[model samples]
Target: MRIGLLSFAHVHAEHYQALLRSMPGVELVGFWDDSVHAQSYAERYALKQYLTPQLLLAQALDAVIVCSETSRHREVVELSARAGVHVLCEKPIACTLEDAEAMRDVCAQHGVTFMTAFPMRFDPSCGELRQAVHSGQLGSILGVNGVNHSENPSVHRSWFANPALSGGGAVMDHVVHLTDLLRWCFACEVAEVYAALQWTDGAGENGTALDTAGIVLLTLTNGVQASIDCSWSRPATYPRWGHLKLDVIGTDSLMVIDAFADHLTVYPPDLTRPVQWLGFGVDPNQAMLTAFLDAVQRRQPPPVSWQDGYEATRVVLAAYTSAQQGRPVRLRPARCESTEDPGDGQGS
Candidate 1:
């Protein structure tokens, strides 16, 4: 299948480009990005670089992988859908629920498959925990706790800090990953959220709008309570780029996921870190992209639906709202409204 990249502004764009080129069924037709750095990276990687979206769509590619800024996701997805190209857009669909809904509606109207890039769902550790919950090994899930921490305060791109460009803050950027995980594991929706956020005025060379240090309390629709502690204040000397840990407790047993350790440890009075390790050695981005392509090829829905993306976005947006208000915020049900049609304009 012919594949094209909508934008290279996202850090993961290079990985996607490499994955597309390496995957057996995909051909990297070209890439389009407004950023000079993104264009330079595309040229260095030897991929065709397009100067405009019109040029990229003209390629008549089977799908477009969007790794643009979080705020620009709606525009890219809408444009791709209008061009009759399936889309695999990176997470945090848009800065607002309204835009996210618009993107979904456009894709549906155009009959183009839409998938959000959430690779954590495909992680081996996550997979095992999901299976444990589904198999009744964990009984009825009662509570969940998660932590996503990183020391890298420096963002190569400036948008990472601007609320207008990248959304609220680190919470908006990183919390979506955990929200998506919780949704997939429990099949539950976040009914309400209470949070506390902190920011540092001391500027690190990285111009970050806020250093993500916060705590979030979540009440799920199924009466399960969950908490997420997200921070970017870890000492720079820390070995890992980031840490993702989840503890899911049920009536009878509990499952702990340590993605950093690449293992799932279950506790049944005694903590039993599984003796056998399941390695998610495959490139998550590649795997997700391939799944999107397969859905397009088979005329089936994408693995992660647009509604899933909207739901996840709702959770993150709620956390931001709650944190800012210093009180709990109840989330409304997800909804989409159609917009006036924009005719497809094609060139890559």
Candidate 2:
């Protein structure tokens, strides 16, 4: 499959380039980016760079990866769909629900595949947790808790702080991963959200509207209560700012995934490692890109569909709305069943 890159503004673009190059059945036709810096970066990677979307689309590629700024996602998707090209868009899909829905509709109308880049779902450890939960190793799930914290970006990449550009700070940028994970793990939708937001000294100094600290309480459709603690300011020396810890309480046992420790610890009155470490030792970007290529070649749906992307965006958007209104925000009921295994199947 011939693939074209829509933009290179996102920090994750390098991951995509490396993965696309390594995939067996795919070719990196070329790339397009509006910013001169982005174009220069693409060139440094030896990618054929173009100045406009029209030129990129003219290559007649089979798929396009939209890794542009969040605000430009809808436009990129629309262009790709209109050109009869499949799309793999970066999250949080678009800046608003309307734009996300619009992209979905257009893709459907054009008969083009639409997938969201939610690589966490493909984690090997995540796969094991899903199986453990599904096989009744853990009984009915009770609650979930996640933490994603990182050092604030320097002023040089201040777009993350701008609401107009990045959507709405840390919640917009970080919460979707956990939200989507929870949906897949429990096979349920978020029913409501209550949240509190704060901006730290760094956020103020950066002159961006993004928050540095926040917490969100969620009520899932299956009666699982989940909470997310997300922050953007951490000591620079911290090993990982994006540390994630998940505790899934079931009637029979508890499953914990310590992403920072790179291990999945299971507790059944006696904590013991499972027969398999769910955390596969593979690069997530490579696994996800390979999956995308497989889907395209087989003419099958992507593991993380456009609908999945849209639902996750809705959940995150609801959290932002809840924080802004100082009241609980109710989510629309989910239209489809959630996947049990959020695995990007690469053995470590």
Candidate 3:
């Protein structure tokens, strides 16, 4: 299948490009990006460059991965949908609920599949735990506590700290991953949200004000309580970009997930930068892409539907609202419109 990349602004775009090129039976037709760095990246990767997204769409591509900044997702997805191209959008679907709805509506109207790029769902550890929960191994779930802590993203991309560009700070970047995980494992929606936010280490603002650390507490529809630490408080010297862990409390047994637990840690002889951790596990991104490709090729709906993306975004937005209001915010149960094979919502 022929596939095009919509943007190269997100750091993951480079990795996704490599995956697309390496995957069998898939063609990375080309990519489009208006950023000044686009030419250098395209040249270094020997990639075809499209001056405008329209030209890339004119290639009659089968699907496009939209990895633009958080705020640019709606525009790119709408364009791809209009061109009859399925979309696999990066998470935190949009900066706002309204934008997320618009993207969902447009894709549905155009009759193209829309999948959220939520790689955690494909993580072997997360998938196995979710399966155990669904198969009644966990008996009755009591509560879930998850941590999605990461190094300050501004160290790599300054846009991540800008609210206008990224929606919020660490909360915006990390909340959706765990929220989607909880929803997938429990098969329920967030019924209410409460959050507490803070800015520490003198990490100042980026264009718009942003919180550097936060914790969100949520109550799911099935009476299960969940808490997420969506903080960017990891030190710069940390080995990996970030790590996710979910602790599931249940009546029968407790299950824990270390999403990137397959890693070897090393202490270097050099004192200056001594610690290094190497990951040696199946690439969850590859698994997610494969699922999306299968859906596109088989003319079946994607595993992660637009409604799933919208609901995840909604929960995150509500967290922000609760933080700002200094109180709990109630969320109405979301209505799912598609009968897609959810398959545990690996992509989001």
TM-score of each: 0.86, 0.87, 0.94
Q: RMSD to native for every prediction?
A: 7.9, 7.1, 2.1
Query: Which numbered prediction scores highest in TM-score against the true structure?
Result: 3
lDDT of 3 by residue, 27-64 (tens): 99999999888899789899999999999999979999
Q: After aligning candidate 3 to the native by TM-score, how far in Å is the CA of 241 from where it should be?
A: 0.4
> What is the descending lDDT order?
3, 2, 1
Candidate 1 collision pairs: 55-348, 58-347
lDDT tens digits by residue: candidate 2, 182-279: 88877778899998998554464346445777898999888889999987766654444446668888889988886546645434455352232333
* Model 1 stretches astray by more than 4 angstroms: 202-211, 235-237, 263-280, 335-348
lDDT of 1 by residue, 217-288 (tens): 889888889998988766654444567899999999978887767533333355343233233455556557
How big is the RMSD of model 2? 7.1
All candidates' lDDT scores? 0.76, 0.77, 0.87
Q: What TM-score, to 2 decimals, does candidate 3 have?
A: 0.94
Q: Which scores greater on lDDT, model 1 or model 3?
A: 3
